[model samples]
Target: MSFVSEFRSFIAKGNVVDLAVGIIIGGAFTGIVNSLVNDVVMPVVSVVVGGIDFSNYFFPLNSAVTATTLDAAKEQGAVFAYGKFLTVIINFLILAWIIFLMVKGVNKLRAAEEKKPVEAAPAPPPADIALLSEIRDLLKNR
Candidate 1:
C-alpha cells in the first residue's frame, strides 16, 4: 500500500480517533480546572489567608529586586516563586480528586452491572428434530 493510504488507514482506526477526541476534551477540561483553581477556589483561599494574592508572593534572590508583584520581581532579578508553586499544587490536588471521584463512580456502576443476573432463554429445537420427536411420541402411544 502507498504511504498516504497507510497513514489514512491508521488514522481511520477506532483507537486513534478516540485518542484524538480524548486529547481535545482533556485540553478543554484543563482550561476549566485552571479557571476553577485561579478564579473560584483560589479567591476563597485568598480570603481565608487575609486576601493576599499568592501569585504576587515570592522571595527576591537579589537585594535590588524590591518590586511587590511576581512579574516586577522577575523583571528586576531572579526570585523563588513558591506561592505560584503552592497554587499549582492545589490545582493538581483538586483535579486529582475530581478524577478520583469520577473513577470511583464508574467502578460502582461496573460493580452494579456485574451484580445483575443474566438469564439465558432456552432455544427451540429445529423443525426436523421436532417432527422426529412427534413421530416417536405417536408410535409410543400406539
Candidate 2:
C-alpha cells in the first residue's frame, strides 16, 4: 500500500478515532475542572483559611527580593513557590476524585446491565425419536 493510503487506513480505524475523541473531550473536561478549582473551590477554601491567596504565597531565596507577591518575588530573585504547588495539588486531587466518581458510576451501570437475566433456549428431540420412546413406553406398560 502507498504511504498516504496506509496513513489514511490507520486514522480510519475505530480505536484511533475513539482515542482522538477521548483526547478532545479530556482537554475540555480539564478546562472545566480547572475553572471549578480556581474559581469556585479555591475561593471557598480561601475564605475558610483566613482569605489568603495561595498563589501569592512564596518564599524568597535571596534578601534582594523584598516583594510581597509571588510575581514580584520571581522578578527580584529565585523563590520557592510551594503555595502554588499546593494549589495545583488540590486541583489534581479534585480532578482525580471527579474522574473516580464518574468511573464508579459507569461501572455500576455496567454491572447492572450484566446482571440482567437471560432466558435459555430449549432443545427438543427429533419427532421420530420421540415417537419411538412413546411406543416403547406403551409396550412396557401393556
Candidate 3:
C-alpha cells in the first residue's frame, strides 16, 4: 500500500480513534485538576499553613545571587526549587485520587450490572425427540 493509504488505514482503527478521544479528554481533565489544585486546594492549604506560597520556596545555590522567588533565583544562578516539586507532587496526588474514585465508581456500576439475573429463552427440543415424546404420551393415554 502507499504511504497515505497505510496512514489512513492506521487512523481508521477503533483503538486509535478511542486513544485520540481519550487523550483529548485527559487534557481537559488535567486542566480541571490543575484549577482545583491551584485555585481551591492551594488557597485553603495556604490559609491553614499561615498563607505561605510553596512556589516561592527555594534554596539559592550561589551566595552572591540572593533572590526571593524561584524564577528570580534561576535568572541569577542555579537554585534547587523543591517547593515547585512539592506543588507538582501535591497536584499529582490529587489527580490520582480523583481518577481512583472515578474508576472505583465505574467498577461498582459494572459489578452491579454483572450481578443482575439474566433470563434466557428456553431451548426447543429436537424434532425427533419431540415426536417420540408425543407418541409415548398418546400410547400412555390409550
Name the best candidate (by lDDT): 1
Cα error, candidate 3, residue 117 (Å)? 1.8
lDDT of 2 by residue, 1-142 (tens): 9999999999999999999998999899999988888899888999999998988889888899899999989999999999889789998999899889999999999999999997787777899999999999999999
Candidate 2: where is the Cα deviation over 4 Å? 1-3, 119-142
TM-score of the candidate numbered 1? 0.76
Report lDDT (Cα) of residue 84, candidate 1: 96
Per residue, candidate 1 scores C-alpha lDDT tens digits across 56-122 of 8799998999998999999999999999998899989998998899989999999999999998788
**Comparing 1 and 3 on lDDT, the stronger one:** 1
RMSD of each: 6.0, 8.2, 7.0
* lDDT of residue 58 for candidate 2: 90
lDDT of 3 at 140: 100
Better of 1 and 2 by TM-score: 1
Q: Report the C-alpha displacement of residue 68, candidate 3, in angstroms.
A: 1.1
Worst 10 residues of 3 by lDDT: 64-73
For residues 1-142, write the lDDT of model 3, one tens digit per residue.
Answer: 9999999999999999999998999899999988888888888888899999887888888896688878888999988898888878989999899889999999999999999999898888999999999999999999
